[model samples]
Target: MSGGKAITCPACGGKIEVRAAGFTVNLACQNCGSLLDVSLPEVVLIRRYKNAKDRFALEIGKRGTVFGQEWEVVGALRRKDQITIWQEFLLFNPYLGYRWLLVADGEWQFGTPLADRPQGDRNRVFWRGENFSRLGRDQPTSTTAVAGEFYWRVKAGDTANATLFQSGETILSREVSDGEENWTQLVPVDETEIENAFGLNRRSLPRRKAAQGLMQFKAAPGMEQDDLGRMFLLAMAISLFAAIAMALLAGPSTKTSSMIQVPVGGQIAPVKIGTITVRRPWQFVTIDADANRFENRWVDLEYNLVDRSSEQSIDAFGLVEHYAGTSSDGAWTEGSHHGDTMFGHVPRGTYDVYVSGSAHGWPVDPAVTDAWGSTETINLTIEASTGAMSWGMWWTLVFALFAWPVSILWWRFRDK
Candidate 1:
């Protein structure tokens, strides 16, 4: 969808495209050296990607049985020239362990066949449901279907013990002493298993069986009563210890010392006035106040007449120069200024104070033609000290009082 009207550059009148990446806007113009503001449209497009690789083509379907259980082909069997790779899907039964097979084929190599063997030698392979021991040995114990090729070395004697047998009556075996011969198998699993293993289930399983299973398990009778008494005793001990600790730690709460005294009838406190001038009509100056020494203090300021003939009263048009203070580190502090008097507690350190006010909200007055009175600046500084309090400690005590009772109740009832 189209966005709002495009902005044109002021100098060159070129069309500009404006797009927002996050909080900021990106703007660029194709034509001239003009500054432009690009408008963003309301609708944007999102894209989705597929899992397949670029070169290989795929066809997906199900395959037949392996080890007497029906198996599925999770993905297409890949083929290039004469080589083929087949992947099989694994089905897991909690009652049974893991089982699956994958196969790869190129041109089979011919080798010498072993001839003589003792008669009456029998080798057989059978299916054994699942092996819980194997499950316990691997952490994150759960049934998962993994797609990969696995190689196993088999010998005639070793083949007799296999859980899965080949389709033929005789079992193929290799010599143990001459190094193991590798037989490779591959298993392809459903892509959905990746999400399932990660607990992202598109469909919810029925909970009836789970509910029945939970119903079969229960705590011993009177266990709750026993647990309750133990919890109560623990609560009493903790409460007693906490009370004693608090009493011991509560020695004498430190009192905030009063402001350093200046001798009676002594010299008026020196005031350091800082001046901030606005260069542009729309710009305002930020005031910084140190609250550490002067928190919740009062400051008196008088705007000295620089050129009285052109001087104008800033308060006349229902607009006063507004000043707001924030902490040195950028925390907002509450303070207020009216006319020439400002009062509030400021935290210690540097502050970013915002100052703005005019007959109109706009910084520049269009009708103000008198050049001498048009350019105005304000000067400010500290005037007097206000009383201080240990606010952090006081608030901490208040929070503790409010929370202690709740904490005690929670401790008493936790086991129940």
Candidate 2:
């Protein structure tokens, strides 16, 4: 509001200019520390900052560039709560009307009014997909204690209040003062950067780092979930494929067997199940037995694998038993109805299985047991296969299934 109007301060007799382009209606006289209202032709005194000290390390009327544009320090205002006081340096550029650099205690933050910007939702504002919430604490009205030339006529005792909201890396602030409402974006700044930006001394003011409110949250990390999710999916697919390939190369298992029968009161002869040829030196072998009697019965067998080339026999055993009972609590089951034994790392050779087994009826008890009084039949089977490839692939498949989700979660949180 440059109407080219000028007035003389009544208290200090200093010439004061007035602008009607904006809502300026008051002015402060620098010479005698008088606040004058020039709304009318005759200037009037409003109030004064009594015995105010020169608090600014960089005084008003200073000119500098900030955020890559030229700006001038038009006015400096000091506001206070009951316990602490902070300062806002008013910066103005002809093209960019106004912005603020706030200094509270030793903390610093750059703030600029969201001037002429389209409004977002008042109830729910989001920036870069981050939702903003009110800080929940109300800012008390702070009266302007000092001032210089202003676009708006600023007088002593003019008060303003600010409400804060947080949106991701930025802080959104709403200021309400002097019947004016404007939203502002706030970014954290350190004392050194502030001084360097404004061309002030490095030790310009006390560096108390008054980083309160939303500024504190800036230290926390941000989540970048998409990257982690992608990495997890890729690793999971590769691991699964490798496991499947390994299991496929393990080849098939080969088996051999024999059958034997013994009658009641007759001698039972140990039988040879059959021979297994190990094509690879470190393959695995398995021995199995199926035994039964006419009466309800179970069988226990002692087995051996004799390598024909080395004449070395491996000692092993197996049991096939079944028992069941019903009680008031519930029905119960015990013992396995099948029996088998596995041997790993068998040297390359032909091997034969020698087995001997005894049968028992259900009427027998553990404390006192007897062999079957009738004939029993038994069948033995021996199988061998390559050990390394099959087991490695199976284990890899199991591990990939278990670890895929964990890899995603682990990086997701780590990134945050």
Candidate 3:
């Protein structure tokens, strides 16, 4: 102020001043509606503009050091859409030139003018090997208010075709008017950062809406989102690979399938099954015995497997029912005649299995089945098998693990 040229307002005859006035070109008269030209040694009049509709939070002429550089809050221009209005404060640093901070509903965006406009393919803006999404179609944004000194002559009633794009937390904005296109890179700033930058000692600031918070600030997803996405992908990959490996391990090398017939009320002689030669590489041995009766009846098979060398008998009791009936709800079917079980760490020894079955849910009157001319005794054919391993539970866990990341990405994009 001391080294600057002292001049009186051309319209009010009041003192017109510029602080740290190095390259200041235009100054607004506070006492009168006059835009003063301060480029020359003697200040002159430009044109008068209207006062702002709302008072500003950051006072004009207040100096603050940001990013190791001191800046003065010089000019401010308020812009409005149909129903929403926000202020853009222009900050000037001697060496850094001019930047702007747009504040809307306590959300802030600090932007710097770009000398070159970004390239866009179709509607997507591309910069720094990243893609940006557009906020809306380009439209006119009108300037509603003007105040303080600026490097350029700006006034109310001027309009610019503006468009905003988002890339992570950064926003790319373009404004064009009268063949002049201005591009800026806007970086989101929260209330804490804004308060610290302006040295405000307030305890709390206004809260942003949940909807608006998505677009108002934090224009891009931070590292946490990217890290989560990568983690989910890793989980899917690892689980998929593990599942395939387990499927191969659990696949049976030799299927020793045999059959035996048992009377409905009687038992069948124990039949010898080949010993499992699979060693520790296979986690466990799975045994499957499917008992089938030609009639529509349930066969409850009391079964047991014995290691012939150790003489340790393992109970393998199971049920096989063939039920198909038409109900009011729909056609219903339940219970397959296939029962499977698994044994952990079965040693390499000859195995023998015995099965005794009883046919239940049979008509007390044989007359009912005799009318259909069926036999009195139903034969139960038992088919036995063994696998190298059992990984049904493990497969379920792996599939669930793979789904976690997919669900996260689903919701993330859905909301975004």
> Comparing candidate 1 with candidate 2, which one achieves the higher lDDT?
2
Candidate 1 lDDT for residue 83: 14
- List residue ranges in candidate 2 displaced over 4 A: 1-8, 15-24, 38-43, 48-54, 82-84, 116-124, 127-130, 153-161, 177-180, 197-416
lDDT of 1: 0.27
Question: Cα deviation in Å at residue 212, candidate 3?
Answer: 20
Q: What is the C-alpha lDDT of each candidate?
A: 0.27, 0.61, 0.64
Q: 2 or 3, which is superior by TM-score? A: 3
Q: Which RMSD values do the candidates have, in order?
A: 28.4, 15.9, 13.7
Best by lDDT: 3
Candidate 1 off by > 4 Å: 1-244, 251-259, 262-416
lDDT of 2 at 300: 65
lDDT of 1 by residue, 21-112 (tens): 22112222334322122223431111111222311111112233334443322221121111112222232222232233222231111111
Lowest lDDT 10-residue stretch of candidate 3: 212-221
Summed backbone clashes in each candidate are 14, 3, 3
Please, what are the lDDT tens digits per residue for candidate 2 over residues 1-416?
A: 12335677777667655433243455666566677666666666877544344456556656766667766665677676433566777776666677888876677778877755434654446655567765534455565466665556665466666666776557888777867787888887767765665666334453344545433322122333454456567777777777676555434556777765533223355777777677665566667555442334466667777889788997777666767778898987777656666676677777787777666657752232246543434433433333345454466666756564565355323422
Candidate numbers sorted by lDDT from highest down: 3, 2, 1
